[model samples]
Target: MKGVSTIQSFRVYKHGLKRLIQALGTEYVNLQNVYERLLVGIAPSHRIEAMIDDPFGELWREAQLLGRLRLRLWRSFKNFEDTVHDMREAVQEMMEKLGIGPDGEVEWIEHTSIRRQYKRVSFILQRSNYHDLLTRIREGVSSLQNMAIMNVNMESDRILRSQVRLNQLVNVTSNNIYHALRSTMTCRCQRLHEVGLRLTPPSRTIVPQDSDDDVIKELQFRLIISHMGPLATPSVRQWSEVLLQSARSQVREEPTTPLATKSSSSKKSVKFSVRSSVSSTNEFMQASAIIQPATATFSLGSAAMPVDSGMPQQIRDLCETMQTTEKRRSGDNCGHIQDHMSAKPSEYGVYFMDCLGDCENYVLVPLKDVLRDQSNGTLPPMLYSDKLRLAWVIACSVLQMQETPWIPSCPTHDDFYVVQKGGVPQYQNGFVLKHLPDRGGPGSTSTSTTSSARPTLLSLGIILIELILGQPLESLQPQDTPASQLSPSYEAANKFLGRVNMLGDLGISAPCNVVSVRYLKARTRRVS
Candidate 1:
C-alpha cells in the first residue's frame, strides 16, 4: 500500500511539473515578443538619429545584455524540460517493475527506488534555479521598457525647445515692461530658462467684398512674465560684439563706385555726386538701425556668438544709444498700462518673458486656489479622467526634471498652476512653476540642505494622495495632537490609510480607494 501511495504521489508531481513547464513556455514566448517590439521601437530614426547617437549608448548596452540573458534562460528551460521528461520515463519503468506482496504491499526495492528518484528530482529542481532566471528576465524586460520611455521623452523635449524658438539676443535692460508686471503680481516668479517663448498667433482676416465692408486685422499676443535676477552682461556683450563685427565686415566687402568727371559739366556732375553720396550714407544708417533690433529679436544662441575685442567701443555706444531711445519712449510712467502699446519696463530690473503659444483666450491661476474653491463648493469637482491625466503629467514632469535646477527638490501643490479660460479652470492644462533661489538670502543654505535631505518621492506620494482625497493632507490631521511634537502630515497619511475603506462610503470608487491606500501606506513606510 505504501509503494502504491508513493507511485501515486510521483504521478501527481509529474503532472504539476508538466503544467509549470507549459506555463513557463507561454511566458517565454510573450516576453520574447515584447522584447522584440521594444528593440524595434528604440531603433534610431531620421527624426531622432542625433538624439540617440553616442550620448545614449548605455541604453543600447543594456538592451544587448537583456538579449543575452533571454537566450541563456531559453537554453536553461529546454535542458530542464528534457530532464523532467527523463525523470517521468524512469518513474514509469520503476512502476512497471513493481512486485506486489500477498498482503497488498509492493516490493521494498521498488519503493526505495521511487523514493531515491524523488530526492534526485528535488535536488535537480533546486539546482536549476529556473524561478530566479525567470525573475531576472522579467526585470530585464521592464528595465528596457523604461529606457525606451526615457528616450522618447528626451526626443520630445528637444522638439519642444526647438519649436519655442528662444530669442537669445533679447536686450534684458530694454525689455523691462515684463519685469514691472511680474513685480506687481502676488505669486512668486521664476524664469523658465529652458523654455523661453514669445508667440503671436496670426489673426483671421475678412477680405472686403463691398465698399462698406473694409476691415483691418491685427495680430495679438498674450504676454506671461516672470521676474529674473541681474542679466548675464558678459553674454549680452559677446552677442553685441559679434553683430557689430559682422556688419563691419559686410561694409568692407562692398565695392566703391567711381564718380563721373567731365570738364564742361564738372560743376553739375560734382553736385550730383555729393547729393548721391549723402543719400546712400543715410540709407545705410537707416538700414543698420532697422536690422539690428529685428535680427536681435530672432537670434537663437548665446554660445555661438563670437567675441570681438576691436568693436567693444562701437557695441557699447550702440547699446547705450538704444537704451537712451527706449528710456525717452517709456518716460517715467511705470504704472499699469492697459494696452500693449503703452507697456514699458520699469527702472527696477529685468524680467523673463513667455507667451501663450497658439492659445487664444486663457489666463493662468494658482492650482492651490482652484482646489480651495472646489473644497468650498464654489467650483465643480474635477472629472475623473482629468484627475488621472493630471497625475500622469505630474509623474512625467518629476521624471524629466529631477536633475534640473528649475524643479525644487521637494515640490508641493503650490508649485503647480492651472489655466483658466472664460472663468473656468482647466485642470488638465496644469504646469509646474520654475524655482529660482534668492541670491545671498538668509537661510538659503539651510533650506537647500533640508530640502536635499528630504525624499522627493515621499513628497510626490503625498501630493498624489491629496489629489485622490480631494483635500489637503494637513486638513486631515488630528486636532488633539500638540503642535510642538506633531508630524501632522505623516500622521494624517497613516490615519487616512487606516480608514481607507470609508472612502467608498463617500462616493469614491473602489479603484480610487485602492490607489489612495497604496499611496498612503508607501508614504507611511518612507516616513518611518
Candidate 2:
C-alpha cells in the first residue's frame, strides 16, 4: 500500500513539473512570434540610410542599436526555450521509469525490483535542481516578454510616423544591393568584379519530356559570366592577350614524345588539305553574317546546323595557323608571350579560358520574347507560382546589379533573358546579360536627376506589374492619354495607382490584395 502511495505521489509531482515546462515553452514561442513580427515591420527602414550622407546619422545609429538589442533578446529567449525543453524531457523520462502513463495514470508493477526502481527514481526527482531551474526560467521568460513588448510597441510607433525620403531611399537601396552582392561572396579572398559576358543565340536540341504536364520544373538562362581577380577590372584586349599567351605557353610545355611526333606528322598532312579547301575572306564573312542573325526569330520545327559542320573554311584555317605557331614555339621556353603572361596583378588573379566554341549552344532569348510568346499562345501558360518566383528573382537581381555594368540604369523586360532548350523555354533560368560598353561612347556613369530618383525601383515595380497582369507596361497606357506626352514615371505611377484603386474595389478577396493594401498604406502614410 505504501509503495503504491509513493508511486502515485511521484507521478503527480512529475506531471505538474512537465506542465510547467510546457507552459514556459509556449510563452517563449509567443514571445518569439512577437519579435519576428516587429523585425519584419521595421526591416524596410533598417540600414536604408547607410549609403546616404544625410543628417539622419543619429537616427541610423539608434536603429542599429535597437537591431542589436533585438538580436540579443532573441538569443536569450532561444536559450531559455532549449533549457525548458530539456526539463520537460527529464520529467517525462522519470515518470515513464516509474511506470506512469502520459495521462498520469500509474501502471501497477508487482515485481519487487520494479517497486525499488520506482522509489529510486522518485528520490532522484526530488533531489534534482529542476524546481529551482524552472523558477529561474519562468522569471527570465517574464523579463524577456516585457522587453519584447516594449520594443515591439516602440518599433510600431516609429514605422507609423516615419516617412522615407525618396532620393535617399534610392541611393540607399542601390548601395544595399551592392553590399548584398559583396556579402554573397563570403570568402574575403574573393571580390565581385564586372566582366564582359557575351551570349549567343540559342540552338534547340530535341528531347523527350518526363511528363506531359505543362508546368516547368526548372528554368535556366544560358549566359556565361567570367570572374577575374577581386581587384582586376575587365578589359577585352587584356583578356584576348592572356588567352593567346596561355595557348603559346601550353605548346612550349608539351614534351617531344612519340605521341607528339605522330600528332605533328598528322597535322602536316592535314594542313595542306585544309588550306586547299579554304574559302575567300569575303565568302567567310557572308557565312558568318548568315549565322549571327538567325537568332532573331526561331520556329519549333527548325533545328540548328551542327557547329563544326557549319564552321567557315577561313575560320578553320585561322585556327590551324594559330596551332602551327604554338607547335613552332614548343622548343622556345623563353618566349615573349611567356614573360608577358606570367606577370601577376598585385592582388590575386584567376584567369578563365574563354569558350570560343559553338555559340549556338549558349544562346539566350529575352524575357520579353517568352512573355510575348505566352500571350500569343505560342507557349504554355505560366503558373502563378512561376510568376511569383520570377518576380522575386528579378527583384533580387535588380538589387545586385543596379549600379554595376551588368544592367542598364533603367532596365526593362528586354534586359532579362530566358534560356530555351529543345524548343521549350526554361522560364526558371532567366538571367541578365552584362552590358558591353562601346569604346569612346557616352559612358553609363552619368546619372541624370530623374534617373537618380528611384529609377530602378520604378522599373522594378513596372516589371512586377507586367508579370502579374501578363502584359507589357505599354499595354497599361490609358487609351485617351498619349504616352509620348507623359514621362515614363508619371505614366507608370498613374497605371499602378489605378490598379490599386481597382484592387480596393475588389476588397481583400483578390489574389494580390495583400500587396495592393501594403502599397496603398505606404502611399497613404507618405502623403499624410
Candidate 3:
C-alpha cells in the first residue's frame, strides 16, 4: 500500500508539471496573436482566409510559441540555477520516485499521450479573453482600409503606363493615315474623275455630258468616300517603324515633359494628365499624308461598346450604388465564414493559395464563357490553345466593353465575387481592388463587378504570343522555362496560322524579336 501511494503521488506531480508547460505555451501563442494584430491591424475577411491557409502563418505562430516556451523555460533555469549543482541528483530522484530504477537506461516514453490532456485546458485559458480580442480586431479594421488606399497609390504608375501605351498606339494608327491622305486627296480624286470620263461611251460628249446638279453630286460623293476611305483601308507597314522608334524614345527618357493637370474630377477623385513629348519624326507623320501608312481601323460607335449607354441614368446610378454595398456585405460574410474554421498557423498558407486560386479561376472561367458566347461562330478558323493569352484577351474585352474611363483594367475578381454575391456591386465599379491580408483577418473585396476600360495594345501583342504558344502565365516563371526555349507548339501552329495570320489580317506586323525564328526556336525549347 505504501509503494502504491508513492507511485500515485509521483504521477500527480508529473501531471501538474505538464499542465504548467502547456499553459505557458498557449499563453505565448495568444500573446503573439495580440502583438501581430496590434502591429498590422485586421485584414479583410477574404485576405484573412488566404493568410490562414498559408504555411507562413502556421510556421510563424509555432516558432513564436516554441520561442516563448524556450524563453520561459530559461527563466525557470534562473530560479533553479542554484539547484543545477545537484541537477543529476534531482533528475535521478524524480525518476526513482516515478518507479523507474536508475539503471541510466534510456527508453521510449509516450510523452505525446501525456501532453494531450493539458492541451484542452490550455486552449480554454488561451481563449478566455475572446471578447477583448474581438473588440480590438474591430478597432483594427481601419488599418486594412488604409492599406487599400496605399495599394491604389502604388499601382498608379503601372496604370498610367498602360494608359500611355494605349494612347500611343491609337495616336500612331490615327495619324498614319490622317496625314498620308491629306495631300493625295486632290490628285487621287481628279485621277478618279478622269478615269470615269474615259470609261464613258464614245457617242457622248468628250468631257462626258452631265447636268450641274449631277456634277456637284458626283464631287460630293467622291469627297465623302475619300474622307471615310482611310477608315476602311489597311494600315501601311511603314507605320510600324514610326511606332518602334517612338517606343524606343519613350524607353530612353524618364518623362517627356511634365504638364499641369486637374485633380479630383469625381467622387473617387481619379486624375488624368499628359506629361510626355512627341518626337520630330512623329511631327512629320502628322504633317504629311502619303508618308503615313493606313492600318486596320475599328469603329468607336455604340455597336463596339460592351455596355448599353441607353439605360436610365437613375437606374445606372442605383446599380453602381448597389455594387459598392454588396462588396462590403460579402466581405463581412467571408469574415463570418472563416471565423468558424480552424485558425491554426500551420493551415494558413495552404488555405490562402487554394482559396485565392479558386476565386481567380471562378471569375476568369465565367469571363471566358461570356467571350466564347459573344464571338458566336466568328472564332478563328485555327484557334490557338493558350490559356494565358486567352485570359488577357478576356480581361481586355471586358475592359473595352465598359462605358467609363475609371474601370480598372485587371481588377481582382475575388473582390467582384464577394461584392456581387452581397448584391451591392452597383457603385464604385471602376476602382481596382487589391487585398493585403493581415496576420489573421478578413481581406478586402471589390465594390464593383464592372470595369469600363480596356488593356493597352502591348498587352494584346503578348496575348498573341501566348495563343500561339499554348501555355499558361505560370510558365513564364523565371526558373521554370529558360528564355532560350519557351514554346514548340507555336512552330506547328505558325505554319497553319501563317496562311491567315491574325497580325497580318489586322494589318500590323510584330517586331522581329517577337516574330523571329530564333526567338520561336528558343520558345519551342522552353516549352519542351
lDDT of each: 0.36, 0.39, 0.26
- Model 2 lDDT tens row, 126-167: 635345554544554465456666655564343322212222
lDDT pick, better of 1 and 2? 2
What lDDT does candidate 2 reach at residue 306? 14
TM-score, candidate number 1: 0.32
* RMSD of candidates 1 onward, in order: 31.3, 25.9, 33.4
Tally clashes: model 2: 7
Q: What's the TM for model 3?
A: 0.17
The order by descending lDDT is: 2, 1, 3
Residue clash pairs of candidate 1? 176-345, 177-344, 177-345
Report clash pairs, candidate 2.
Answer: 200-363, 201-363, 202-363, 219-428, 219-429, 220-429, 221-429
lDDT of 1 by residue, 436-513 (tens): 223334333122222443355655655666666665665556567677634324445546654544654333334434
What candidate 3 gets wrong by more than 4 Å, as runs, is 1-371, 374-488, 506-518, 521-528
Question: For candidate 3, lDDT tens digit of each residue in 1-528?
Answer: 855655565455445434433433343334334324422323344444343323123322332332222222222312222222232233233333322232322122234443443333233324332334333332333333343344344444544444444433333322222222221222322112100000010111101122322221111000001011122331210000000011111112222111112212321110111112123223322221110111111111110101112221211121112222212321121100001121221000000000111121212122222223323433332233223333433344333322221123333222121111121221111112211111222221122342322123223333343333322222433465665554323343344344335445332223212444544565568799
Clashes of each: 3, 7, 51
lDDT of 3: 0.26
- Candidate 3 C-alpha RMSD relative to the actual structure: 33.4
Candidate 2 has what TM-score?
0.41
